[model samples]
Target: MRALCWTGVNETSVETVDDPKILNDPDVIVKVRLTTTCGSDLHLLGGYIPTMRAGDVLGHEFMGEVVEVGSAVQKHQVGDRVVVCSFIACGQCWYCSQELYSLCDNGNPNPALTETMWGSAIGGCFAYSHALGGFAGSHAEYIRVPYADHGAFPIPDGVSDLSALFASDAAPTGWTGADLAGITPGDTVAVWGAGGVGQMAARAAMLLGAEQVIVIDRLPERLEQAHQHIGAETLDYTKDSVVAELKERTGGRGPDVCIEAVGMEAHGTGPQYLYDQIKQQLRLQSDRPTALREAIYACRKGGSLFALGVFGGLVDKFPFGAIMNKGMTVRGAQQHGHRYIPRILQHLADGELSTEHLATHVMPLEEGPRAYQMFKDKKDGCVRAVFQPNGASSTSY
Candidate 1:
């Protein structure tokens, strides 16, 4: 099997590796049909997340057919088409029972590693890093899925592979942010970043009945997609002051909900961007939180702010004062994909949600390295670079 292996910072290659086999009673082998690069994967490529090794496979969002299943895996069998969650979970854990699958207590194989950094171990994630879980990623012909019954949701009839592929991570993560923020009718929402997750978050806000949906990013192509596909008003942060533009648009009150989907790799402007860049280069801070700070400052008093982006470590000069003075609610989580994938699939089946446009660049898995480079650079309007391991039909170029 050929897999995309992360060899070093900003380096990856396609290397042949051993095929996966069923390892536990709750496990199954999935022959990957489709997989895609995520913005979070950019964090891994840029060395923002820690504990990655030379030979680690690098992918998390994927869907496929079940090739083999353990005896205990009764919900699925050979040939069952399904989308697996990016994070692993144990169904019997207290958090899983509460529908917080990402915080499952018994998922991460190496809890001590994460506990030292984040104070506790999160649920195991496919190819995220050693601290999260060292599970092999999905950017290959096949992958071993643990706790199959809990994490794998069957693709409903009529949903294309392209649509189900994102339900694994991007769409669900965006939906998680909107759901947690409690978007209500007439609420105004602003999302930072115009990548797949941000686009989905903007669409989710509108679907949840928010009166206005605004997307922020520096990229013209992404902003155009937000305007054309999701009916969102877009702001190019590089061209306009985000805080001022947001305030003016909302009649000087700011948005009721602000979502930070740009994560640690946010491109900042002016002094803060320069300061964060210098600190990051010197290893003084693990995250560059330009978008997060703006989100906090731009949110209305008593509003909600959700951090949908991946932050591996501590940030410098976060505005705790704004949060305190304004009585804001802040929340973030890895996508609880198990809790949301099913509903998203139903929406896809019902023609209520369409993700066909998000897969902007599609190529065979052999071009994994180039695909990632284009995605990371946002070249040629590459919103989501999807790789078809089986070379299945694609929706777009």
Candidate 2:
């Protein structure tokens, strides 16, 4: 089996590895049909996320056909097409019952590893790191999906593979952010980062009844996508002050909801951003909260700010004052994909949601390294680089 393996900081390669076998009663082996790069993968590639080791498989967003299923996996069987959630969950757990699959108590096998950093383990994620469960990711020929009944959702008859691909991660993540923020009718929503998740968040805001949806990013292509596909008013953060423009657009009121989809690797245009960058590089801070800080500053009084971005640890100089003085609510979570994948699939089937545009580059799994390079550099408007393990025949769209 050929898979992308993380070897060191800023380095990865295709390595032929041993094929996965069913390890748990609820587990299933999936011949990966399609997988894609995520912005969060940049955290792993840049060596920001801790506990990643040499030869760790690296990818979380994927969908595939079941090649084998374990004894207890009754709902899924060989040849079943499914999109597995990024976060592993046991449906019977307390948190899972509450639809909080990302916080499932029974998911992480190595609780002590995350307990050291986060005080408690959240959930096991495919190919994130040992701290997050160390499950092999889907950027390979095949991947082992555990808790199949709980996390794997079958793609509907008419949903394209490209649409189902994002249900595995980005769409659910954006939906989670919007769902948690409690968007109401006529509310004004602003999303930072026009990447895959950000674009999805913008679209979700519209679907959730936000009267005005604004997407912020420096990338013109992404902003154009937001404008054309998601029907969002786009802002170029580099050209205009995000806070000022958002306030002006809202007629002196900031956005009612602000979503931060840009995580620890946020780039900045000023000294504060530069300071964060330097400190982060020196191991002085665990993340760059540039987008988060802006979200807080740009959120209206009594508004909500939701973080869908992946922040590894503590940030320096966060505006606790802004959150306090403005009476704002702040919340964040890893995507509880199990809770949202089904609904998103329906939206895809109904033509209410379109994520096919995000798949800007599609290639065979053998070009994994090059695809990642283009994705990382954001080259040629590469929003999401997708890989087809079985080549073109595996693609349904």
lDDT of each: 0.91, 0.92
Per-residue lDDT for 1-397 in model 1, tens only?
9899999999999999899999899999999988999989988898888889998998999999999999899899999989999999998989999999999998889899878888888899999988887999999999999999999999987899888888999889999999999899999999999989999999889989999999999888889889998889999988898999999999999999999998987897899899998898788999999999999999999999999998888899999999999999999998888888888999888988878788888789999999999988889889988888877755322
Say which candidate scores most in TM-score: 2
Candidate 1, residue 74: how far the Cα is off, in Å? 1.1
State how far residue 124 of model 2 sits from its true place (Å).
0.6
- Best-performing candidate as measured by lDDT: 2
TM for every model, in the order presented, reads 0.98, 0.99
RMSD of 2: 0.9
